[model samples]
Target: MAISDGETWVLASHNAGKIKELRDILAPRGIALKSAVELDLPEPEETEPTFEGNAALKARAACEATGLTCLADDSGLSVDALDGAPGIYSARWAGEPRDFGRAMQRVHDELGEAADRTARFVSVIALARPDGSISRYRGEVAGTIIWPPRGKGGFGYDPVFCPAGERRTFGEMAPEEKRQLSHRARALAAMIAAEFGS
Candidate 1:
């Protein structure tokens, strides 16, 4: 199915940062996003083993609940040095309140001066329709974890992720800049291109 201009889609996420980021990305296309949190939909447990699985699960849940077209994003950082320790568990590592500062510290401590700081951020976008059809797209960006986290922009592990070939971290980059290179943005672009064309 294709999304036309002015179509409304439910974003199956409660994170304010994610909602804002998605809104910014879709606004130019005249697509309006209503987040699940705004609709008072319950957050489903992410029991899926992979990003694609979790994204589809959440999108399907939201579509079933609201009977509307829904989108879900399951994204996280995977550090090569740690053998992708925080891949799916990135959010859990932060605990209930979602203190990313502590999570960043844990990464630093766990790394413990390892020479290899290579990491990559992965994003899977799942779109579910009321007709019970679901489609998924995946994007990834390689980067290295930096010490002493920089910048105040973006969220989650952005402060510590410096995408390959860039000296600045994701948090240090402007929204427009990040959008140009981020995994989430890439995934969204791929999905839109496939479904909506150009």
Candidate 2:
């Protein structure tokens, strides 16, 4: 996974947002990234029950498809009061068009008047090599849900999520600011530590 040995690797995701963030993170590191959408690879069914499992499924699928080293990300928002719901189904909850606004509202409606609004964002990054070796890393951030939403930056349930001790919502923070506390960033950091090291 030290990527210092490879010229290019597949980012096993059709999500442009995810790809964009990966590109931003990887490009400066001297790694070339190709998205599954860009490669026209099929997205495997995320039937796995956990983030790590799903990430492995996607990474393996893409590696099998293109015979290249592939990396995939599976992440979600888990609401404590909601009993970890919307964790694996984070994207599905947004529906076909990916209307996060509706998803946010649904959380608001479902958790009506609850005192405990604690939540967390979780992420898992899986990398599958062509030789069938795989490595996984995880990251998370604790936060609380807010009402009426706020700002307009990050995607998903970001508008309503405020990281612990932060005055602004994830949606209100700048991309750089958000990245500092982002689950994905933490996951990537772990991946680098395990695979690339300092």
Candidate 3:
């Protein structure tokens, strides 16, 4: 799909951090963006079993509801030791109130042996048109979990997982720096190249 200047795209998510990230990534191409929150879009049910399923659900819902091009992303931290768990349920891992600290602690507890601490952040992005046509992209970054939670910059599992070749966790890096190396960013880059041609 060719993206033309002035074309508006809806990002099917209400998270401010995600909205900001999408805006930053797509703004340079002259695409206008609107978030789900801004459009008062309903939260679509993520009953799907995989990231691809969840992403497509949101993208389809947003496109059908607004009659606009839409993009949706579903991402999570999957630990090798946890049997790829906390996959679709990452957001609910901490229960009601969404305490990421608690969720991280749970992960640490589940993987008692530090040798089993290896993990990766995975992201899947789906883009859909009002007519139901869709395209998907995926990306991941390998890392290991730290016990004490090292940084203060990012949200969720950022404070504990340190990406390969980096001493500091993502939470220690500036948002822009993190964006350059994050799984979501990598997926978005691929989507852009695939849809728009480098």
Candidate 4:
């Protein structure tokens, strides 16, 4: 599962945020990343029930399309009070054109004065090879949702998610700061350790 320096891999995502974060992390290690959008690849429907399954599905699709190694991630915010209502359906909650503001409001509305505000961001990264082999890694960061959604920086539900031991939500943090604590970063770390070494 080792990757060599200077290898180009396809990122199985069209999300600008995820692509930037992954490129920032992997580029220094000498890996070049291209997004599915850049390659004009079709996005596969994520019909899997879990994060790992969905990630693998996307990665496999990209890998097969390009005959190149591919990386994909399935990530979401799960609220404890809601019993993880939007776990795998995170993106779907945002609807078309991805209106995260609406999704965040729905979370708050459903919560409706509930005492438990605990939640966690979950991510699973899947690496797929041209031959169809796949490896998956999972990461999570526990946090709580805040009302009145703070900052305008990060995409998705970052404005309301305050990680444990942090006063500010992810949206309030700089890109570099948020990257240090993001669920995606943690998952990428595990994948790098296995495929790209330290």
Candidate 5:
């Protein structure tokens, strides 16, 4: 499970935010990253129910399409009060074009009157070879949802959710700080450790 230095890795995602995050996470390790959009790869359908399933689905598609090692992640914010309403459907909550504002607003509306505001951000990452073999990693952070969005640094629901034991929302943290504790970063670190024996 060793990746050679200077190997090109395709990040199977169209989101600019995710691409930036992945590049920032892997760049320091000497991996060269190319986003799916950059490669003109079609967005794979995420029909799977679980994060791992979805991640594998995308990774497989991208690997097969480009004949390169592909990395994909499926992440979502789950609120205990909503019983994880937007677990797998987080991106689809606002329909096509993906409106995070509408999605976040809907989450707030649905959680109205619920005493519990506990929530968690979960991420599952899969690295797949063109031959179909795969490796996986997962990370999660427990937190509570703030009524009004705070800060403006992170994308998605970062402004409204604060991880447990943290005084500020992810959006309030600097990029370097957020990368240290973010679910995606945690998962990526785990994957790197497993692959490189770090």
Candidate 6:
């Protein structure tokens, strides 16, 4: 396994919720993990044009900064009606202090009954060694948007997106339940199978 049991690695993210989700998946594999914020590491700007590129950018920056093996993910909601908008700008809509409520409202307003509420959450994860090259994995969850956010569990657009064939939005699902059906989870699972072989 490239990154296996008993190994401590850096998770290049500042979001506590994201870190918690990572632990929920990685901890059972006997991997000890740490986040960039936990280590007080600088977060690299996501300047890349695509999810894979952005993930690689962050992973490389974290690995170079701390000399630790790092893993990073870049994910966003892409609405078909919006022409795949709010893709890279997903985080930007959160504003300086990160208010997702406002972001959600903006999406609703922008969407305005376009008939096609089809959307998908896409995640690209990159694992980088101290030397900075990386292996990448991608995952996506297709769903449709529902007006007025639902239960409050996940961050971002979770409250309004209902996965295909499911009535509950991600925000309505428990953490473990979300893990079972999440873009991030799929990405992590793929990463494990690709690099760790388990």
Model 5 agreement with the true structure over 42-74: per-residue lDDT tens digits: 998899989999999999999999999999999
lDDT for 103 in candidate 2 is 89
lDDT of 2 by residue, 12-89 (tens): 988887888888877766779999888988888999999999999999999999998889999999999999979999
Q: How close is each model in CA RMSD to the real structure?
A: 0.8, 1.1, 1.2, 0.7, 0.9, 1.1
Candidate 4's C-alpha lDDT? 0.93
Off by over 4 Å in 6: none
TM-score of each: 0.98, 0.97, 0.96, 0.98, 0.97, 0.97
lDDT of 6 by residue, 100-131 (tens): 89988988999997899999999999999976
User: Which of the two candidates, 1 or 2, achieves a greater lDDT against the reference?
Assistant: 1
Which 10-residue window in model 2 sums to the lowest lDDT?
A: 1-10
TM-score of 1: 0.98
True-structure lDDT of candidate 5? 0.90
Model 6 collision count: 0
Off by over 4 Å in 4: none
lDDT of each: 0.94, 0.90, 0.90, 0.93, 0.90, 0.89
Q: Which stretches of candidate 3 lie over 4 Å from their true place?
A: none
Show the lowest summed lDDT stretch of 10 residues, model 4.
Answer: 189-198
Tell me the tens digit of each residue's lDDT in model 4 across 25-61.
8988898999999999999999999999999999999
Error of 6 at 97 (Å): 0.8
TM-score pick, better of 4 and 6: 4
Measured with C-alpha atoms, the lDDT of residue 93 in candidate 5 is: 88
Best by lDDT: 1
Colliding residue pairs in candidate 6? none
